[model samples]
Target chain A: MMLEFIQHLVNGLSLGSIYALIALGYTMVFGVLQLINFAHGDVYMLGAYIGMYTAHFFQLGQNSSVLALIFTITVSMITCAVVGFLIEKFAYRPLRKSPRINVLITAIGVSLFLEFSGQLLFGPDPKFFPQIFKPSGDWSIGELKINPLQILVFFISIILMSVLQTIIFKTRLGRAMRAVSFNHDLASLMGIPTHRIISYTFMLGSGLAGAAGVLVGLTYPKIDPLMGTMPGLKAFVAAVLGGIGNITGAVIGAMTLGLAEEFLVGYWAPTYRDALAFGILILILLFKPTGLFGVKQTEKV
Target chain B: MKLLFSSNSRHGIASLRNWILALVLIWMAHFFVADEIDPYFFSIIMYAGINIILAVSLNVVNGFSGQFSMGHAGFMSVGGYISAFATTQLETIYPEWFAHSFLMSLFFIFILVLAGLGAGFVGILVGLPSLRLKGDYLAIVTLGFGEIIRVFILNIDTIGGARGLPNIPALSSFGLLYSWVVITIFCIWRLVNSAQGRDFLAVREDEIAAEAMGVNTTQAKVRAFVVGAFFAGVAGALFAHYLRYLNPQTFDFNRSFEIIIMVVLGGMGSLTGSVLAAVFLTAIREALRSLQELTRIDFRMIIYSLMLILLMLTRPNGLLGTRELIDFIPNGSRKKKKSLESHP
Candidate 1:
């Protein structure tokens, strides 16, 4: 039982890392734009498709895992970044001055568009992602067995997250991002090119989502047009649970959510997984609306 | 307030004339177009009408009340399932005892309305917690409530669970559906124009100022939510009877989002806009289905996403914003500016 519990914990962490990556994208955009990018999930889905196609093109079935994984990641990230840029330039930029509700609807429209277009283009069948990485070894500590892929996901996620944190906190672009997030008007007044900053934010967020998609594809080895919907929703919930605009909060929230989901599925039933997530969201809202580590916003009349 | 629309009370006559003209046009369409419509198309129109009701009612809370509720479908599901269980089971258990069709249908409609009321009561319960929250926080709460409702429904065996309930008698038709539509429109229009409507507007505009001016912000929100939920319930009844199906998935977050999209695209507080947008969206969806066969491109949703993005970028206030068609008339000028200002 203890060994099974440890194995679940490892599995949960691996899943949580992907969720954290996706959640980070949501939190970053929300932090700066104050807009929920409803298309974020689709972007993630796009990432998986990109990675899968790229691997397939190279004929990297499951053998040349390292090279194929790297190639897929690079290709997916670039493609997703481009898509993200276009979405921002065309769909979101026009509605900047419009009511927030308008943007929200537009986001939904974009989401549907992605789903349907993907179905049309990709044929709606679940594409098998060519697993490049074969678990070379497994380590067992007591009853808990640590798979190589699980370790790979954890290490890659940590490295990427650490790098991302540094860029957001320690760099000039990060300061500009922070400046704009606090007050776009003020940031512009202070000579920050608000549009450029927002574009960068979108790029960064989409890139992260793309990377997450690659990881998720590797883990699940299945990609479908509609695959992004659940993960996207779960990531959104994670972002909110961690506080909408806080990056660290997103990571923590995703991990917690992942662990909770795993435990619930293990103890209760698989069907209740989503319900459990929503239940936790309600509980969090009831007690801490700002989310864990989120700053409470005061409305200016 | 009366003086705002009255030019020494003479202009009131002209405004009333315009209102009557608009009503006549709608009535004419109802009588002439509805009568000649094919049964299949008529059923679709009836469904559209129900959707219009749901979208418009949700707009009251979301658009006019300035609250983002992604849980309208939850209220709808509650109303639908409850009414279905009541009308179907009661009739099934004792068919001969209550054998009168007209009377039975009327009784069922009453029970459906009461079921809506119960859903409204649940809306109040949900809305209460949301009173303290704002924007995205409130959105999540409502979303959570919607999901919880779906999950609970899935677990409840009495309502047929995931398999869904069937064999519901159709209670809506061209005549009955239109009657309800007209009544709903009238009541909603009246409500939006009344003192309560102004309070709702005030709350939407600036809750702090409204509260400062003696408007009970909480009460106003609750009222809007309850009223919205009531209509959503009624729409659910229409759905239940028309489709003769009820499932937990039918009321999930996606359904909630669909209704929200209609409300948003329709111009928020504009009642006429919601109705028109609902029709437009339904028509577009149907058109897309046909187009898919010819184009071999399943990217219809992609086009929708592109359209949404473009719409937001180009016209964030939606297709109509808050302006009704009447507001564009030459002599229908009195309250036009005010309506626009209050809409988005």
Candidate 2:
């Protein structure tokens, strides 16, 4: 029983890391724009497709190398960054002065556009992601079987997160981003080039989503147009759980959600797995509207 | 508060005459639709009626009340499933004895009402807590409520799980279906034009101010939800009978979004606009069906979604911008009434 618990814990951490990656995109965009970029998940779906195509183009699926995997993920990140940039510029930027609901509706529209367009472009059938780097086998510790792929997913996620942290906290552009998120008009008054900053923020967040998509593809090896909807929704729940605009809170929420979901699937009925995140969301919203780490603001009359 | 059958005799008599005329016309049209109209065309008309009910009901909450609800489909599914279950059980008990009888039709209307009530109860549970939330948060919570409902439906084996509940009795006729649409529109129109409806409009325009003006904002919001959800349920019940099958997938977020598009495109808060938008979208969708078949790719949804984005970008106020179609006509009574009130 203990071994099984340990196994589930390890598995949950790996899954949590991917969710954390996606949830960060949600939190950051919410922080800056106060608009949930509903199409962010579709960007992740595009990222996986990009990675798959890159791997195929490079002929990296047969005898995989770490360098080949790195190249594929980097290409995906860049492509998704461009996609994210376009989505923000076209879909969201035009509605900056509109009512919140209008922007929200447009976001849903953009998300649908991506999903259906993806179905048209990539075909409706699910594609098996090219295994660019397959670990030899699993290593057992007592009754617990540890896969190297999980370790790889964990390490890569940590590296990406640390890089994100440095970018957000330790750089001039990062400070500009923080200022813009603090108050858009005020930041513009401060000559922060607010539009550019918002655009960059979207690109940065979407890049992370892209990386998450590739990591998920590496782990699960199946990709489809509609695959992003559920995970994207769960990631949004994670962001809300962690306090929508709080960065670290998003990561913490993602981990909690991932662990809970894994445990639910491991022990309880698997059918309830999808409902669990929403249940937590309802409870959290009811009990603590600001989230675990979110700072609250009084509404203006 | 006593809004039933307007107290003003002249106005009441005119509206009553209009209702009678409408009923006669619908009853007369029923025979033509049943016999002469092609089955395909008839089905499309039925679908248009269902969409009209869904759009108008949703407009009550999202448009008139200014609350963004993304779970109208959840209420719809609740109504659909409950009515479907009731009809199937009744069929089994009676074994086709009253399939086309007047007694069955009466019972069917009763079941539909019961379904609407069931959905309204769910609306209370969903709305009472979340309606207090601000716009964006309320939207998410409603969406979550919708997803939770779908997940629950998917899990329940007796309702046929993901495979869906089938074998519902088809009791929807042209008269029956269109009568509900007319009823929904009339009730909503009366409610909106009444003294109480001003409270709903007040709450929508500014809840804080509305409360200061002694409008029980919460009650108003909840009332809107109950009424809106009740009609959604009625529409769902009608839809289930029309389709004779209730698939959980049929009532998903996509369905909700479709209804929302109708409301948005029709100009929120305009009953006639909702009706026009519903019929227009359904017709356009049918027109696009052949293109999809020829191309062997589903571009209809792509075009629909793109149109949504463009519509939001260019004309968020929609076709009528909260004004009814009648208001556009010269010397319309509603317009004249507004002018008289202003002058007085």
Candidate 3:
């Protein structure tokens, strides 16, 4: 029983980290633009597809080389960054002066556009994510077994998160991002070049989402057009749980959500596993609307 | 006091006559279409009617009350499943002779009302907590509520689970659907034009100010949700019977977005705009069917998403911008009066 619980824990942590990566995209974008950027998930979907294509093109399946995986992930992230940049330039940038609801609706529009276009381009059928490395079994320490892939997932997530933290806290560009998110008009007045900062924020956030996509693809080994929707939604829930605009809060939220889901499916009714995220969301919204780490802001009359 | 009562009765009689006249015209139109027009066209009209109800009711929450609810379809499915279940069970219990009886139609109406009430109760449950939230947060909560409802319904086996509850009897006709549509429009129009509706508008315009002005903003929002959910329920009942099938997938977020599209494309607070937008969008959907067939690709949604984006960009207030069809007519006194009232 203990071994089984450990197994679930390992699995849950790996999944939780992937959600944390995706949730970072939501949190950062929400922080910077105050828009949910609903298309972020679709961008992640595109990244996975791009990674698959890159692997297929280079014929990377025979060798389980770390360099090859890195190359594919890099290519996917760059492409997704460009895609995110373009989406912001065209779709969201024009609506900056509009009502928040209008922008929200447009975001939904962009999301649908990406999803349907993805279906058109990739076809609706699920595709196999090419194995970039040699297929292997779990590494067992006595009774408890751990997949090397889980360790890889956890390590990559941590490295990426640390890199993100450094960028947000220790870098000039990150300062500009924080400034813009604080107040766009004020930031621009301070000569922050707010539009450029916002665009860069999109690229950074979307790049993280792309990396997450590749990671999820490697772990799950299946990619489809609609595959991103559920994970995206759950990650959004995690973002909300962690306080939407708070980075560290998002990561903690993702981990909590992932572990809860794993335990729920493992012990409780598996059928209700999907509903659990929204259930947490409703409960959280009812009790503490600001989220776990979010500071309350009173509206001024 | 005597004079006021006499004027009120006279006004009531005049409205009652108008309602009867509208019903008679609708019945005539229903007969003409049923007997003469193609079944495809009839189905289109029925769907348009349903969309009308969905759009107008959604406008109550989204437009007038200024609350965002992306879960209208969730209430729809609730009503659909409940009404479908009731009909299926009742059909088995009653004789075949009872199916064609006048009493059966009345029973079906009762079931639809019961379904509406059921959905309204759920709306209260969803709205009460979420109403305290503002703007995007409230939107997300409502959206979450919708998804939770869908997922829960998917887990129930007796209602056919993922396969969906099917084989609902077809008790709805063009007349029945449109009559309900008319009733829905009339009720909503009256409610919006009444003194109570001003509170809804006040909440929509600014919740803080509305509260400061002694408006029970929460009650207004909850009322909007209940009214919206109630009519959406009625529409769902009509829709279930019309199609004789009820799939959980039928009332997903996509369906919710489609209804939102109609309300947004129409002037949000305009009753006539909602009706016209429903008809226009439905027509466009049908017109696109030929293109869909030609390409053999489902580009209809692509076009729709593009339209929504473009519409938001260029004309966010939609076609009418909160003005009714009647308001478009050249009425110097009414126009001057409206302008004065708005500015003042």
TM-scores computed on chain B for all candidates: 0.86, 0.93, 0.91
Off by over 4 Å in 2: B7-14, B96-100, B293-296, B336-344
How should the candidates be ordered by lDDT, best one leading?
A: 2, 3, 1
Report the lDDT tens digits of candidate 3 across residue range A1-301: 9988988898889999999988999999999888878788888899899999999999987786888888888998899999989999999999888878888888888888888788789877789998885447878899777888888988889999999999999999999999988888899999999889899989988898898888888999889887777788889999989998899999999999999999999988888887899899899888887789987878887
- Candidate closest to the true structure, highest TM-score: 2
Quality of candidate 3 docking, DockQ = 0.54
- Candidate 2: residue B141 lDDT (0-100): 85
Q: After the best TM-score superposition of candidate 3, give how far the Cα of residue B178 lies from its true spot, in angstroms.
A: 0.4
Residue-level lDDT of model 1, residues A1-301, one tens digit each, is 8877887888889888999999998999998888888899999999998888888788777566676777778889889989999988888887787766667777778888888788887877788887877676688776667987877887788888998899999999999999999999999999999999999899888988998998888888878988898798788889989988898999999999988888778867777777887888777888887799899977776
Model 2 DockQ, alpha carbons vs. true complex: 0.52
lDDT scores of the candidates, listed in order = 0.81, 0.88, 0.85
TM-score of each prediction? 0.90, 0.96, 0.94
lDDT leader: 2
Rank all candidate structures by their DockQ, best first, as comma-separated numbers. 3, 2, 1
In model 1, what lDDT does residue A280 have? 80
Top-DockQ structure, candidate number:
3
Expressed as tens digits, the lDDT of each residue in B1-344 for candidate 2 is: 45756644444323766876787789899966577999999889999999999999999998888898999999999999999888888788988756557888888889999999999999999999988887778888888898889889999988889998888888988899999998898788878777777888888778898999999999999999999999999999999999999888887787888888888888877788999999999998888889777765567678778978998899886677677787777665353434211100
**TM-score rank, highest first?**
2, 3, 1
